[model samples]
Target: MSYLVFEQVTKVYGAVEVVAPFDLDVPEGELVAFLGPSGCGKTTLMRMVGGLEPPSSGQILLRGERLKKPDRRRGMVFQSYSAFPWLTVAQNVAYGMRYRRDLSAAEKEEQVQHFLALVGLTDFASEWPNRISGGMRQRVAIARTLAAGSEILLMDEPFGALDAQRREFLQLELRRIQQEEGKTVIFVTHDVEEAAFLADRVIVFTRRPARILAEVDVTARLGASRTLELREGTDFFGLRNELLHYVRSTASEEEGTA
Candidate 1:
């Protein structure tokens, strides 16, 4: 069985069906992105996988084990700016390990340092949240999630709040962290370029009561290197345009029907 599996998963709220029955299976260490326009149920799908919300029907399994409820094994990053204003970068990361009474103080510190360095925020470890930029705060959020020992990371438009340059930089940073940690990631984004740049495979979805519309395999060869050259490469643009074309066509069809 695949590491993470969503089989005919659906979510309905009262009279409204937000996400249709959709199926996906991700191998143990793959990074996948969900791309679509707003209101397309991307966030809902991520929530379902994170176990924050239960599926109306169907199943979600990780490592062949069924996910019954939210647990520490799955981490999440939201679009909302989620850093505690009072906490320093290191403190923020340490917050995740608070509930783990089993770990000694020294062990928790080691985990915090490891994840901070993974995201290139070791220098900012003592800096307050307000002292750094939005991008940096988001990095802290990511590091905190990682420090919690979650093997699966769920990101919902995590970079949507940053400027273009920062967003792009963080995307590369995320890719690097994913590589180093070998974490299973399901990232949700509306940006086609973001999906193309970061994902091993891009899954597209339809409008509300969303279903998987298409899937594109992004085969960029960049490893842990975070050079701007990856974004400018022919493969990047090619894959990005393909996803954009899918979104545009879907939008056009919706307009015609309206």
Candidate 2:
């Protein structure tokens, strides 16, 4: 059985359907990227998995259990700065563990230190969120989610706010963390290259009332862990261009209708 299941899940606001009846299966420890145009319902579908938005119909299942309300088990990292301005870097990461009943205070502190070191923020543990750069703040957000014991990460363009260089760096950072933490990630992004770089599999979506356009397997051809060097390789382009073809075809289809 698949680790995560989107069994005929859908989203609608009033009479407008943002997502059509959709179905997908994600395996454990795999990073799946939803790539599509703006307002294409990719994020909407992801939100349902996180339990942030209810599916108008169908269900989101994790390990065969239905997900209903927002839970710390499936944490989210948003595009905007999500760290608490008043909290220090360590505090932000530790904050998520406050509600973790299984962990003692000492265990929680250990987790905070572990994640802070994972994201290379151990030195800045005492620094405030407002004092750090945008990229650093995002690192804090990721650390917080993992420290809270969220095995499934729902990332909604978490690095989208950063510049190209910073974005690339964080992509690698996230990839490393995912590899080490053994987390299942459902990433939503508009950037084709970013999706290709980060995802083991990429699911392309059409315009509003989004439908699955294509699913391209990247790690089958590309290496398990991607780097800047791979970006210029033909194998990488093949993975990226394949996703681009599906993305562009959707744009063409929209234009023809209009």
Candidate 3:
């Protein structure tokens, strides 16, 4: 069985249906990117998976059980870096473990250190969130999510706030962490390049009432190292161009037809 399954999931707000019947099966340890334009239902789908909102119908299952509410198993990071201003970076990471009864104090501290290091924030562990760059703040959010013991990661345009260089740098770091930790990641992004570089499979969505327009197998063709230099290769460009074409043309076509 797959790690996560979306079975005919749909979302409606009043008279408007923001998501049409959608189905997807995601295996464990794979990073899948939901790519689409603004106001599309890509983020809505991710929110459902994170247990932040109820689906109008159908179900999302993680490891064969239905998701009912937000918990530590599904950790979400948003575009906005929402860290507790009062907490230092290390404390913010530890905050996620507040309810965890499985780990002792020493073990929890060890995990906080581990995840902070994974996101390259070990040096800033004691610094307040305001002292860090936007990029670093995002990293802190990520470490916090991971340290919370979430098996699945839901990232909603997490790198959207950063500049190009910082975004690219984090993209590389994210891929490395995913590979090492073997956690399933569902990344939501409107940027074609970012999706191409991060996902093992890129599920490009149409405009409103989101549906999967296309799914590109990235790792099969481009491989998973996903280094900065790989972005310039012909294969990488091909994947990026392919996603861009779908986002541009499919979005325009779907806007009026449906």
Candidate 4:
């Protein structure tokens, strides 16, 4: 079985469908990105995988087991800094473990501290959300998600709100973390370049009521790890332009049919 599978999936609200029927399979330990423009159902698809939303029709399976509701098996990072303003960074990270019966208070503290350091925020553990910069807050969000120890991560443009430099920095940091931990991640972003830099494969989607337009495997010479230099190469643009062309062609075809 695939590590993650979305089989003949569709989502609808009343009479309007938000996502067309689609099938996608992600292999174990792979990082894939769903790339498209705004309102193209990328976030919706991520939400389904995260168990925050259910498909109107079709099945979502992880490791061959059907996913029916939210569980700690999947971690998620939102585009917004979702930390509670009143809570300390440590408190924010520990919030995810409230339902777990396995960890003692000492163990939870240890895990929280470990994750805080993982995201380079051990020094700010006692600060409230408002005292931190936007980038730092985003790091806290990542640390919180990581602390949950979930095997799969569903990220919805986690660095979208940051400055370009910070976003790029975090992308490299995320690649390092994913490699060290061997986690399967599905990241959503509208930026094609971002997808190319971070993904093992990129799934491009059509506009509203989105469906997979094309799936491109990037064959850049990053040599098993992502790097900024890879993004500047000719091969990167070649793959990216191909995806852009496919998306445009699909959009035009849909318009013609309508």
lDDT value, candidate 1, whole model: 0.87
Candidate 1, 75: how far from true, in Å? 0.3
Kindly provide the TM-score of model 3 when superposed on the true structure, using C-alpha atoms.
Answer: 0.97
| Per-residue error (Å), model 4, residue 119 | 0.8
Q: Count the backbone clashes (under 3 Å) in each candidate.
A: 0, 0, 0, 0
Instruction: Give Cα distance to truth, residue 253, candidate 3, Å.
Output: 2.9
Clashing pairs in 2: none
Candidate 1 TM-score versus the reference: 0.94
Task: List the lowest-lDDT window of 10 residues for candidate 3.
Answer: 249-258
Instruction: List, residue by residue over 4-48, the lDDT tens digit for candidate 2.
Output: 998888888999999999999999999999999989999999899
| Poorly placed runs, candidate 3 (over 4 Å) | 254-258
| Lowest lDDT 10-residue stretch of candidate 1 | 218-227
TM-score between model 2 and native: 0.97
Ranking by TM-score: 2, 3, 1, 4
| C-alpha-based local distance difference test score of model 4 | 0.85
Number of the top lDDT candidate? 2
**What ranges in model 1 sit over 4 Å off?**
220-227
Query: Which regions of candidate 2 are displaced past 4 Å?
Result: 256-258
CA lDDT of each prediction against the hidden true structure = 0.87, 0.92, 0.91, 0.85
lDDT of 4 by residue, 87-194 (tens): 998999998787788999999999998888888899999999999988888888877877777889999998888889998999888988888888899999987778
